[model samples]
Target: MRLRALLAERLVSRGLGETRDTRPQASRLPVLVPVGPQEDPVEAEADMRRRLHAVPAGTDLVLRTSGSSTGTGRLVAVSARSLLASARATHARLGAAGRWLLALPAHHVAGLQVLVRSVLAGTAPLVVDTSTGFRVPALADTLHRALRGRDPVYLSLVPTQLVRALQDEEATRALRQVDALLLGGAAASTALLSRARAAGIPVVTTYGASETAGGCVYDGLPLDGVEVALDAEDRVLLRGPVLASGYVGAEPGGGACDVGQDTRYHDVSLAGGTGQGIARQEGGTPLWRPGSRLPVTLRPGFHLLPTALPGELPAKGGTGTVRVLATPDRGRLEEGRLVVLGRADGLINTGGVKVDPGDVEDALTGIEGVAEACVVGVPDQEWGTVVAAAVVLQPGAALDGAAVRRCARELLEGSHAPKCVEVLDSLPLRGPGKVDRRAVQLLLSRS
Candidate 1:
């Protein structure tokens, strides 16, 4: 199967599954897939056989961002501690350990995380081969058997997969039976999410990336021991046990926070905080937001974990204490939960003003006739770079290009409104569910 072909080397090297030895080996240096989204997986696996590969010591698994749709990628080294920290935090949030239904591509961070989480769960995950495309019947059959297990069953799926499943009554029924459906990999519309939740499906929208070992924040809340901070530019700066060591081959990142020092408890140099220590309310939980400054030197060991139950954590590797990994995504805190706006690099510069395309996309999708929208900056002599948009209208809905721009102006600032709007049958995708913004830029450039 494509899943095995893509992930066999990674899984076997990590010593996963009863099919393999599945034993933790301390001598094992970090097993790196190390290939970016656009690289060949077969070639990446071949790199595993080389005897001379080198990376920072204590690094466990090295993965890359599947920026396939965004036309970007980064290779990050995630230490053993960090991987487990991410897995354990997920368990703490989900409230139970069970079989994970792997629905995303195995090479992707979210799917790779299924392996990491399964190790802690002590239950082998049932994987679906997504390389051939998502089949609703396959999902139905798998969920049926998984639901029969003694332990609770969990499923991870992209929003596109969920959309497909929602269309088939059998698939929808099977999905409703799972523990919690993790919806991520791309942004889900408010209309789609509301419909899923309203249909008795427990849908949890996740926010995070490969740098954090996948989905560190769930449904707008940071996981246990994971802290979220915003840089001076309002870009998200992630810290704590879930953070990756840093990008592979990049120069050592300079941040205000230094980690792996002597501190079991979390200390703060955060933005929107009152005192030196993290402020606590009535429940004794520290308020993660409202810090005084956008400090990138934020270290780990933030939230207190639950007492060790049997198999509460993967009994492997060292502590994942490290400095902040600054993300390209722009975000803000609302009621202490992180609200990711869009990519910082994706901001459009027009007439000396920067506009967030994510904000524009949100406004566009909110319109009645628009089914999907992709926003990008198009080069223009007058404005220098004007906000341009490409949209896929709902089936049978005829939306005029001018009407689309008029609707956008009503919902957002003039600068945020699309100067050029193009209608398309569908947005080009670089991978499953993710929009190819760069391709959309090329398409919008022609308009």
Candidate 2:
């Protein structure tokens, strides 16, 4: 049997049996499932059975999207060919040829890609427990163990994991031990990436999804056979060998090829909030729109665009197409290097203007007594929303809301200035470096 067929067979035998049916199963995998710290193989098996029941027979493709909390939750269908192509493309791009530390959940495409790459490379991946979230201190030990074999060790981490690793001195040191670290899943804050680079961590930003098997674009460049294009709307679209086949629960005639004109192109629009475009054909020609009406463009054969429309209009008023596709949520491609903004979700829309909280945080990084800061939009009747900042002070340092606000005004426009500031010993971080915006909202609500 061909390698693709063998892979399909293996995938079917290993919890993907539901894909073998031609008719869709009654119940499919939940689009989102949150796994706790403990692993229950029996429960997992049962869940897999339930999920498999939803897919059609002879369907080897499976689609999984990201959940609200990060990790694995979304489900999309992908063909074995797409998965293999993605693995091969990643291996070729990274030139990976050794053991890898798998700290992400197996249900996630990123984590699953690591496993698939390991198998393709004829090496077993070193698994780690990410059920309780990323434990950087513990991961340090795992990294050490994975490196003992003298094989070129590689690992993938989200910004949250990178932040935690940076917090631990040992883990920071351990980062240098790997051949490469693919930092992705979401945008890494500028502060976080700066710290990682300063620590001499060989980190590369990656972009892709289950549709592409894994990371199809590394550091703003497409992998071999992966093509990236931007539509008139500035949304990013992708076409390549690594693209997935389709989605599991997608409406009939809803695959990537249904967008407009051709299957070779897809639409990806950032402005639409779908974070992906549509694949359509016009006059037998394929065209991709970056910004689609859907909240997310999932399914195989459709690739997320690499570029987004500029958040703000250019200063000179020169006319250019502004499109938005979802990937690398923070940074953008400026010149050639990826210049990261903070987070799209982190942007504080105040008075009809979007303000990246990181912009404020970055300007205040060197302030006399500020240790860390988070900026958020607070509800205000006067203005649609007012800019609010939460600051963590350094030990033995004195700072006040007025002082911080004044400082912010000096560094930012009046429109971006903070109306209220709160001082704290430390900001609440969700996983590692991620500021819990919801918690921040709650903090202000009580204040």
Writing each residue's lDDT as its tens digit, candidate 1 over 1-447 gives 333332334444556432447776455443556343456778767654542244555565666565654575545666656666787889889998788888766566787777677777767788775546668888898898888978888888876577567767898888888888888887777766866887899998898777787898898888998777675567676667677655555323311233323223344332222222232223333223432234332232222221112122312342222345556677788888888887766788999999977778878878887777888899999989999998877656768778898899999988889998988876776544577788888888986
What TM-score should be assigned to candidate 1? Answer: 0.74
Candidate 1 Cα RMSD (Å): 8.4
**Where does model 2 exceed 4 Å of error?**
1-63, 69-73, 250-256, 260-348, 357-376, 388-407, 418-447
lDDT of all predictions? 0.67, 0.60
Model 1, position 402: C-alpha lDDT score = 85
Best by TM-score: 1
Question: Residue 275 CA error for candidate 2 (Å)?
Answer: 33
Worst 10 residues of 1 by lDDT: 301-310
lDDT of 2 by residue, 408-434 (tens): 888789878788889976666543234
lDDT of 2: 0.60
lDDT for 52 (candidate 1): 21
